[model samples]
Target: MSKLEDLKTAVINGKRKDVKTIVPELLESGADPVEMLEQALIPAMSVVGERFKKNEIFVPEMLVSARAMKEAMKIIEPILIEAGVKPEFKALIGTVEGDLHDIGKNLVATMWKGAGFDVVDLGVNVSPAAFVQAIEEHSPHLVGLSALLTTTMPAMRDTVEKIRGAGHDKVKVLIGGAPVTLEFAREIGADGYASDAASAVDAAREILAS
Candidate 1:
C-alpha cells in the first residue's frame, strides 16, 4: 500500500506511534494537509465507526483509533489553520450537571474532531446555565449533551430546555450516553440521538445537512 494508504491503515489499526511517524514523513514530502485529512485521517475514523456499529470492534478499539487520528490531527491542524483552512462546522460538547462520566463524551469529541468539526469540549458536570452561556459565546452549529446516569438524565433535559429557552433556534442539539435513548432525546426536544461516537458523527452531519 502507498504511504497515505499506510497512514489510513495505521489509524484503523490504532497504531499511534506509526501515525506519529508517518504524518511528519508525508508532510516533509510536501503532502497537502487538507489532502492528508480528507484522504487518510477522516476516512480511517469512518471505517472504525462502521466496524464499531457492526460489532466487529468495540469501545476500546474505537478509542485507540480515535486517539491515533488525534495524534495525526495534532500535526495537521496547525498547518491547516496557518493556511486558513477552517472546518465547516463547530460543535460544543459536555457532560450534564450531576453526572461525572466523561469517557463517552470525550470519545464523541475525538470522533467529531476526526470528522473535521471544530469541537469545543465543555467538560463534565456542566450546568444548563453553562450550556446556555456557551451557546451564546461559541454559537456552535451543534451541541452535544451527555448523561451517563438515569438519575442525571433530568439535567440533560434541563440543558436542552435552557438552550431553547435562550432563543437559540439555529443550533442543533444532539444527546447521547449509556442511559440516554432516542425516546428521551425526542421527549427532551433534542435534534438528534446517537448511541455512540460514530453514530454521533452521522447524526450531527444529518442534522446539519437538513
Candidate 2:
C-alpha cells in the first residue's frame, strides 16, 4: 500500500509511533497537507468514530486514536498555515455548563479540525454567557455543545436559548454526548445532533453547506 494509505491506517488503528514518523515523512515527500487531512486523517477518524459508536472500541481506544491524529496534525498544520490554507467553516465547541466531561467534546473538536474546519474548543463546563462571548469573538459557522450528564442537559437548552436571545440565530447549534439523543436535541432547539465524532463532522459540513 502507499505511504499515505499506510499513514491513514496507522491513524485509524491509533499507532502513535507510526503517525509521528510517517506524517512528517509524508510532508517531506511533498504530500499536500490539505489532501492528507481530507483524504486520510478525516476518514481515519471517521472509522474510529464508527468503531466507538458500535462499541467495537472503547474510550481508551478512541483517546489513543485521537492522540495519534493530533500528533500527525502537529506536522501538517504548520504547512497548511504556510500555504495559506484556511478552513471552509469555523466551529465553537464546548461541554455545556455544569458538565466537566470533555472526552467526547475533544474528540469531536479534533475530528472537525481534521476535516479542515477551524475549531475553537471552549473546554469543559462552559456557561451560556461564555458560549455567547465565544460566538461574538469567533464568528463561527457552528456552535457545538456536549453534555454527558442527564442533569446538565438543561444547561444545553439554556445555552441555546441564550444564544438565540442574543440575536445570533444565524449561527447553527449542534448538541452531542453519551446521554444526548436526537429527540432531546430537538427538544432543546438544537439544529443537529450526532452520536459520534464522524457523524459530527458530517453534520457540521451539512450545516455549513445549508
lDDT of each: 0.92, 0.88
Q: Provide the clash count, candidate 1.
A: 0
Q: Please provide, for model 2 over 1-210, each residue's C-alpha lDDT reduced to its tens digit, 9 standing for 90 to 100.
A: 988899889988889999989988888898888888888888888788778767898767877888888898888788888989977788999999999998879878877876667899999999999999999999999999999999999999999999999999899999999889999988988899988775788887776777
Query: What is the lDDT, from 0 to 100, of the residue 10 in candidate 1?
Result: 99
Q: What TM-score would each prediction reach against the true structure?
A: 0.91, 0.84
lDDT of 2 at 42: 80
Worst 10-residue lDDT window, candidate 1? 107-116
Give RMSD to native, each candidate.
1.7, 2.5
Kindly report which residue pairs in candidate 2 clash with one another. Answer: none
Error of 1 at 65 (Å): 1.8
Give the per-residue lDDT of model 1 (tens digit) for 59-128: 8988899889989989998999999998889999999999999988998898798788999999999999
lDDT value, residue 18 of candidate 2: 96
